[model samples]
Target: MTTALLPWSKFLICALLIGLAGPVLTRSGDAIARLTGLSRSWIGLVLLATATSLPELFTGISAVAAAGAPNIAVGDALGSCVFNLLLLVLLDALSRDEPVYRRVDQGHILTAAFGIILIGFVGAFLLIGRGALDIRLGHVSIYTPFLILLYFVAMRAAFFYERRAGTIAFTGEKGTETGLAGAVGRYLAAASIVVGAGVWLPFAGLEIAEVMGWRASFVGTLFIAAATSLPELVVIVAALRLGAVDMAVANLLGSNLFDVLVIAIDDIAYTDGSLLASASPAHAGSAFAAVIMSGIVIVALLYRPGARFLGIIGWISLSLLVVYLLSSYAIYLLGH
Candidate 1:
């Protein structure tokens, strides 16, 4: 195969591997969840969420350091939020019981709300970076340090709330208890598989964008973003099937929140001017879409919409899916 075909081929293989790894991740998460006193949301949001976000983390680092394409790094991080929110539709539809919104905890509204703020920070910086607004200490955006601080604070807030909420929101049964060593081993093994596929995704993304002469922003936003997020898709389906509904939803929100942090790392790796400033203005669209979609989720969690339409999912799911499709299309046009 020509070099052009190489990346597409590798992308498919890695995608398949990510799918196969999902169930193992879900099962291992259950063991770990039971071992810890934290509820399902806590486990999924903190541990599983961070684990699955490894793709964006590694992809961002590689895009800047190795690929030397900060735009890809920017698109992947911002676009992943849109992709992650869109997965709510899949999670809701796959739910054989009540709508997923009804199943997960109301506490997730805090997560969704926090996500909106983080994405908004990104959007603000992207637009500001376009002009002479250089709120920077050095090569980095000043917002980078502030965002890092906010992320930890948000995490602490979420942790306290979930811990106090008890199991009222958790739908899944705790897994059978295992020795701590066994749980640790299983968690590490499953995480390793996910990390392996995640690490290779950026290479395929850069090559395909170059061969097709497609903008890195477009390729990263849609193709690379969706591809790297395959783990979230798999884990959501697996966790829901295993009766861990909160884990499924919490994982998405946590990952989206974490996705923004990748930008800070990208800023450091780029070695150029501000990474956000280096990105096309089109990325603001993705960041804005994240805010809007996260609003939809917060509404669903607060309202707990009982009404289902357009098939298996609820109205929130449909609305979110539409917004994402429109946003992706908008990104495409902007790229052209």
Candidate 2:
């Protein structure tokens, strides 16, 4: 009995540690952004997003390098993309006064669009870049460099767009008085905790897969993906409570972008072969699911629906939930 519960216990512990450290990361990130005079949207997309995604980044490396589970690596990254979009449903539900899509800046559509592009790129690589069609540049996919380049381009684009749009607002009772050096220090400390926990996460996931007789793709996508994403959930809620809606929205969409970039990093870490090529094709389903969900977000941002369907969430949130459930079911069927 004790042996049976060991994997889950370890997984939960890592999740708890990440959850506790996550808010600290966000606060420190916010401070750094404030001190540096960067826009809130930019901060959320770059600083907050990267801090929250530390677990995914570390987990991917461990999954590919130590656990030798390429499926887990790929599934976790792509699955987190879908799961983050699912968080939009939660975000929409929490905003009781108005629809979340209508409340926030439309500039987020840019982030979501970039997310779709990156995720679609990954899904395309997984589907077509297999066997003879696969392209490699010395143990890594050629897509690796493109992913990295695209990420930088996306960041630059978002920075200038947010600046031009003049959407730089920091809401809170008090300003961030912490010195820049102090904020950086706190960020690093919180990040180290997340990194350590993230390193152990893949091992726990591997054990859970073995003990439950489940596919690594399923375990990684559904279970491990949610676990690593706990930090984002925590940060998003904290940001919303502080009235930083753009930060919350940017964090979720930005995390998706970074999650795809993690795949490129995973490919480099995975010395065996191309990480995407080695992963199960079922993961492509999650990738495309994310792409569809991102498209829904773009529509929601443009349409800006005011009325809620059942007085709980808007039509956009409902669509997101439906797609998320169907995609999970499909992945379960394929993994099993």
Candidate 3:
């Protein structure tokens, strides 16, 4: 029993560490953006998104290596994508002024759409390769390399497009100074925290699941995904406090994109044909629901007719998610 409970203890410790690192990482990311003269959009998309997502990357890679189950990795990535979108819904509910959906420009909407389409493209490819949702071993042979190239190309395109279109202005915040030494120190500190949390969380999650007699998929989909997503939660709250609605929206959307791209990366790392072979069907359903929820979020943002209406959509999404979880749990109990 003690052995079974060890993972949960580790998970709690990791969660506390991640929670502590959140603000520091945010401060460091903001400092780095100022030091590099990068716009918030770029900073959110590249730096903040990547930093916050390191946990997912680490957990996904570790799951792949340890279980030889590419499905868990895929589900985790997709599940994170869904969870990130849900963060936006939470932000929408929490915002007091103009709904964040209305305050942000169309750039975020485009990015979210692009992310959804990208996921669909990848999902379709996987589906076609194996004639099902199963991850194909050789699917990475073509899919993974192409996705890596595509991600870089898309990023470059976004940068130039934003620059040329004047969609995002490259202005620094007030009283923000660019100091090399400070920037280096903050970067290293943030990197260490993120890496440490990433490395420790999965093992903690595994231990917890064993102790509770729960499946790894449940822990991966719910506990670990929620724990690792702390950075997004931190960024949204900070952005809201600063009244940087656009930045907040951009961060959530960009994080989802990053999570999906990580799927392609995991696929490449996997030696098997199908990434989903080892995942519980319930986990796959959760991932599918996440993709659907993301699509709904995009639609909600695009149709932003009023703040109240937007809030209603968010509530709907939240309700649906709760129902999905309850139904999924019920099914799991029945089967077990």
Candidate 4:
């Protein structure tokens, strides 16, 4: 019966499934973090980031395999970073605390800064490797093992600093007291649904973009980016529900860091040389947007004032994101 549905109907169903899967996976991840004695920030960076980002990975691989459009895949990953940071501002606004930023461990701030630097490095490499020198290298030789090594080093440094500072904490409610074993089972069930959804949503998204006369980069930067960030949204809401504002702030910031590092993984997967070579100029705009959003996040975290102030920042960031989106659309129109 499910197999008999039309393509668009199937796509909508899949997108809904992915949305449903996100909360379950997030809750289960919270449980596992408790069970295994891991920090929420670590879980946010490693598990939640990875699980939430599965959709991007799936869509990117599918895009490359089916259309050979490596730019779409790369754009989707970076664009997800922008979306995740924007989620931070949303979380801050929802929190009941004074300054949501003050609650966050300083290590997160450091990690985020490093992430920004790393992304800048990647962007610089791609931008520089654009022309004649790139051709001489046969293909853009930006994807080197050294890039991956540097990423690891940065990550290890962040982890070590967080641990040494004794600021890492888990803010979720106790799973054991809440019949979490049963919740885990449900989480598993939901996760299966989410995986299936992730697998199918990209196809639907691609089809929708085609019907709307949009470019692949546009589909990836906006639609697919928002879809894959659903888990962060869930995590933020859950944190607010439990008054775990720190977790909410940390999850958003850490997720951005994770997204930036995902570029390293994508680089490894992309055997076709530098990702920039195949991308349109639209990606540069997306990268700039990401940088702007990242800066806003850093400012909010560093200043750490009151709840009203954080909420104000949230509003400002949201406005900026809207502007970025409109600008991107304008650029797309101009190119067409």
Model 4, stretches more than 4 Å misplaced? 1-10, 97-99, 135-140, 167-193, 267-273, 307-323, 334-336
Best by TM-score: 2
- Per-residue lDDT of model 2, residues 1-336, tens digit only: 888799999999999999998788778877876777666678789888898898899999999999899988888898899999999899999998999998888999999999989999999998888988788999988889999999888888987787677654443234455577888899899888989999999999999999988888998999999999988898888888878888889999999999988999999999999998899888889999999999999999999999898899988999999999998888888963
Of candidate 1, the 10-residue stretch with the lowest lDDT total is 168-177
Better of 1 and 3 by lDDT: 1
Provide the lDDT at 64 for model 1: 83
The list of candidate 2 runs beyond 4 A from truth reads 167-178
- On lDDT, the leading prediction is 2
Instruction: Please list the residue runs of candidate 3 whose C-alpha ends up more than 4 Å from where it truly belongs after superposition.
Output: 1-4, 67-71, 125-128, 131-141, 167-181, 272-284, 307-336
Per-residue lDDT value at 227 in model 3: 81
lDDT of 2 at 174: 41
Model 1 C-alpha RMSD to native: 2.6
Across 119-193, the per-residue lDDT of candidate 4 in tens digits comes to: 666666556656763542333254444456666777788678767766444453455645656755766677566
The TM-score that candidate 1 achieves is 0.93
TM-score of each: 0.93, 0.95, 0.83, 0.81
Give the Å shift of residue 302 in candidate 3: 2.2
lDDT of 3 by residue, 6-51 (tens): 6777787777776676666667666666666566666677777887
In TM-score terms, candidate 4 sits at: 0.81
The candidate, 2 or 4, that scores higher on lDDT is 2
Clashing pairs in 4: 98-306, 98-307
**Which candidate model has the greater TM-score, 1 or 4?**
1
